[model samples]
Target: MTQHLANFKARPVACVTGATRGIGRDIALHLAAQGYDIAFGFRDEIHASNLQEELVALGAKVFCQPLNLFDAKSINSFFDSLNTAQFGLDLLVNNAGITKDNLLAMMSQEELEQVIHVNLIAPILCAQAALKIMLPQKQGCIINMSSISATKPNPGQTNYAASKAGIEGFTRALAVEVARKNIRVNCIAPGIIETDMVSDLLKGNEQQAKSKLLSKRLGKPRDISALVAYLASQQAEFISGEVFNVNGGMLLR
Candidate 1:
């Protein structure tokens, strides 16, 4: 029965950062249905425990590790644990990130650094760790969760935009370098998704935001999850170094 839902019975092992909530949680669940054993990183212990329970119910071999992406020591320790476990990681989803919104003029240096460290540097570090294992096997897929804000600037999101834009640059360069090793790198830039993180923004202004979308509605978590699942699958073998926009046609380019 589960085999029908998941096309692959072999079941790839995937690691997803920020899998406790929002888009990351959805991605983890969706991949589990597609027969992936999941190793996830989370900031909050309570949330991580809850997510592990849910994934376990779905019969997924889930590993929920507490990770602070902003801290280099934490990042190194988490990867070291994975290595000691002898888990051959196949798909790496760099979904852990944060936003410190403020106008460029008013944004503090600390705020800027915090956003950059989580959104940009963290992904780079996670990818580097994944590459250490993947390069040897000559196979892997990496999906970095980016934002449409990377291209379409938001008034108070200068720091966020810059960090996301940096992911695009990282994706392209890393894809080229690792193509020979059979490792594929790509990005997903979502716009106005209906997640817990952004529910406040959409609560009373759903109509106004919908007006800006060609689809006439905010994107759902499942919308992005489906794409992530496809990209992680063998169906996307030829695709690499591309930023897929799941934005309800918000940016037409």
Candidate 2:
């Protein structure tokens, strides 16, 4: 049984974390247009408002909430709010993450802990909460955002890469657990996408980055969002427990 707003026609619901910018924002927009009422979490108030307005304009019911990835209460409270609204969430996109890059020897304890907590632990917690909703419904999809760094690790990104690697592992294990329940779990590992998160590195090394990619250009947010939409759809019902790389062939398996 799909979830619906109390007074409106049934619309599949999606809850996305870190939807204020970059790939997260693009996914929210794309899903809203795809006929899913979107309930999103964001750290930035202004950007969240803009996203809410846009989603409404797209003719979708929008639930925008503040999220502090660092705080467990905030994460659970957000899901609680979603459940209270009766959105009947059909998808959860764990797209929020941060990078604190430094050589392991040079990285501070705070940097290491915060990076792992925000990038890895937060998504797991979000999924745990979402399952409370999904399992009972007998239908749902979870799409986690990992990075190519997980496999093709660079020197200073030990923490970032490790966190993403953990996410990939979590996806596989969780997928197996819930596959029998008709709930799918999958992860997407993106290449160097053109987003604010990687702006500084992409700026000076544009040519260097392009040379390595078979696509010869940096990825746009839409590249990742497009795949996210596909994985959330019925066509991908057979796909789960897999990590899809959207890295422009940056590191081929």
Candidate 3:
């Protein structure tokens, strides 16, 4: 039994979307360090290749696929490519997301649709595909990347907030449906993480942003990655349908 347990702990397969950079990239690297083979999907070929190289250097079996979350066909095709004998995934991280920052008054239909499609719908589709594979094994972990904006309304991020809020709701509902199969689903709501996507905002209003946080500092990608690694591990097996806030005390609730 001890030998069997050791074999089980050797390596696990994990798939992370939007892993070319930012929070997703960090999560991918963190998981690899924890003995998980890495498979990530990204829209940019150049960025995806770079990330693949980094993961390979970490001694992980890494596969990077070009996937457009906005395109439903592409999303399905990407997963199909992963449904292979040697690539059975034990963990799925739905981290692919986009933000079209504009007040509701100025938001166009195209803007709202794009955000919803990528942030909410794409994750749902990916989760659905993952569930089919996980059900047979009766074990898997799914982590959805949400945001504090989902709960706290911000002026220019109406579409982003709504999409993230939708993910929160989806996480809770799906967790209940899949718990019987030993599939745990949860979300991580990150607040003001220092990433390339928000470099401009941080650079332009560093002082104002720092003052707003109780921690008096922005969150780092590693901070979020640590929480994600825990939730994906056996250490958090009893945790499900929960939303973790890593926002530097930005939201009390």
Candidate 4:
């Protein structure tokens, strides 16, 4: 704790999307513990309140708001509030995403569009907003939450995989564009994390999932959060436009 305080005289601010639960919540808390003022969005007011209390307890200045990723207006409004509140975001974590599982043949247009809207389009918009603030400061970090599915997708995840793959490409392009400006962009590809997002999938197949990974264990939200903290720090100042795999070696045999 003391070390974290020593690292920053003034706490940096981070805006995280989909922070009501699961990995997003964990990322918000982890950044708070590291002495960052947290500004996060949620679809549920109840979840937002709970997370606000927790972040406040950690000595972080917390700003919680309702966000609808499906609506472009809502995305714009979120950043508007952040700017109005003078939070001056130093980090933006594009962790808000949804999965609408279905094969190409069975998938409805609405379902596919919804997934793409939330998972891919929202991040691009948020990054655009954050840059307005960051470019002036000439320092900021943006971490997009990608997935292992982008490369090794499972059945019925066409929409999810495509959105994640888009994020990787966006991360690379943006990183290069912002390199000279001192802003950084990166992506995190998590595999089979033990979050509510996949609780059902892991219920009866825990052992089966474990057997496939060299670590023989599922990844945790904390696992990804720790890496996010590092990337946001000076240690990773030279690192950008890279997609990091945090899947307990799930990609390997």
Find the candidate with the highest lDDT and give its number. Answer: 2
Estimate the lDDT of model 3.
Answer: 0.84
In the range 102-151, model 3's lDDT, one tens digit per residue, is 98898899998999999999999999887767888899999999998998
What is candidate 4's lDDT per residue for 103-194, written digit by digit as tens?
A: 89999999899999889998999999889888878889999999999999999999999999999999999999998889999999999888
In order, what lDDT does every prediction score? 0.85, 0.88, 0.84, 0.87
Model 2 C-alpha lDDT per residue in residues 1-253, reported as the tens digit of each score: 1122342237888888888888898999998899888888776777887888888889888776677989999999988877766567799999989888999999999999999999999999999999988888899999999999999998999999999999999999999999988999999999989888688767788899889999999999999888999999989999999999999999953
After aligning candidate 1 to the native by TM-score, how far in Å is the CA of 95 from where it should be? 1.0
What's the distance in Å from true for residue 250, model 4?
1.5
Model 1 agreement with the true structure over 1-253: per-residue lDDT tens digits: 0111122225688889988889899999998888888887776777877777777788788665667887888887777776656677889999878888999999999999999999999999999988887888789999998999999977989999999999999999999999999999999999999987798766888898888889998899899889999998889999999999889988963
lDDT of 1 at 249: 88
Q: Which ten residues in a row have the lowest lDDT in candidate 3?
A: 1-10
TM-score of each model, paired residue for residue: 0.94, 0.95, 0.93, 0.95
| Each candidate: RMSD | 4.4, 3.4, 5.2, 4.3
TM-score of 3: 0.93
